[model samples]
Target: GKGGAEAGAIGNISIYDVDFVPLLDAAGQPVDPNPVGHGLTEIDHLTHNVFRGRMKEWSEFYERFFNFREVRYFDIEGKLTGLKSKAMTSPCGKIRIPINESS
Candidate 1:
């Protein structure tokens, strides 16, 4: 059972596939149907809050090597809260590179 769970964990850690879609003009209209040459349309910001130490290094690495940026940092007090992550963006709103450091 231990080996089986470890194998499953390893499998989950790997991302095998990704999907790309077209972006709209905010009026619910399809801007483009083609995806291959289009690349990512946006860069959404996501975060991982309430995490332990050395976790932020992973994000920092992406920022240094992968062009990601560390935009904002927040410290929640007196209660369990989420850290707000921030970054730059491209014209389209589909190519998000989230580098979150949990507090």
Candidate 2:
């Protein structure tokens, strides 16, 4: 039992038997899978809020520091709280962080 758990931990979660099956189109040509933006379609955004004018600076900061890009900017108009916002997402579309500011 010595070092068994440690050795198991190293390879436990790894998937090594990946089958490289080429996806074919209707005409039977292999499809190219390398797209420009790496993304996960179904993801969530962690909305971080700030004051109105600071939104741009904060968004740019995220883009420059982290590998995040601005996907959408929105002007939210709720009855009680109106806000100006922009949403930024990671390269894989996971871990989205939306920055909002009260308007």
Candidate 3:
């Protein structure tokens, strides 16, 4: 009952430690790394979409429950649509989630 529909679309949050197994050749040998690539180390941020009127509520929820503080606010306007967003980050600054709502 902890992370049921009460949590909305963000049902549950789980972090896992993943081991990356290298790509192997036909002979069971690891292939060489990409010459022009710098591999990804970790994720920096994520974005979540909410209903137009619920952005502030979700932002407050993240601040209260996850220790995420508001870092930035954006109001984007296009020719046909507009949106508002609030960026929230964890204390360590490694995680960020931007809550967006279309207007």
Instruction: State TM-scores per candidate.
Output: 0.35, 0.52, 0.61
- What is the total number of backbone clashes in candidate 2? 0
By lDDT, the best candidate is: 3
Q: After aligning candidate 2 to the native by TM-score, how far in Å is the CA of 61 from where it should be?
A: 0.9
Q: Each prediction's Cα lDDT score?
A: 0.49, 0.77, 0.82
Off by over 4 Å in 2: 1-43, 78-81
| RMSD of each candidate relative to the true structure | 11.9, 10.2, 12.3
18-52 per-residue lDDT for model 3 (tens digits): 12357788999987768456678789788999998
Q: Encode model 1's per-residue lDDT on 26-91: one tens digit a residue.
A: 898877665576886644555443246654666666667666555444454436745444443323
Better of 2 and 3 by TM-score: 3
User: In angstroms, what RMSD does candidate 3 have relative to the true structure?
Assistant: 12.3
User: Candidate 2 has which clashing residue pairs, if any?
Assistant: none
**lDDT winner between candidates 1 and 2:** 2
Candidate 3 has its poorest 10 consecutive residues by lDDT at 10-19
Among all candidates shown, the one with the greatest TM-score: 3
Indicate the worst ten consecutive residues by lDDT in candidate 1: 12-21
Q: Model 1 off-target regions past 4 Å? A: 1-43, 80-103
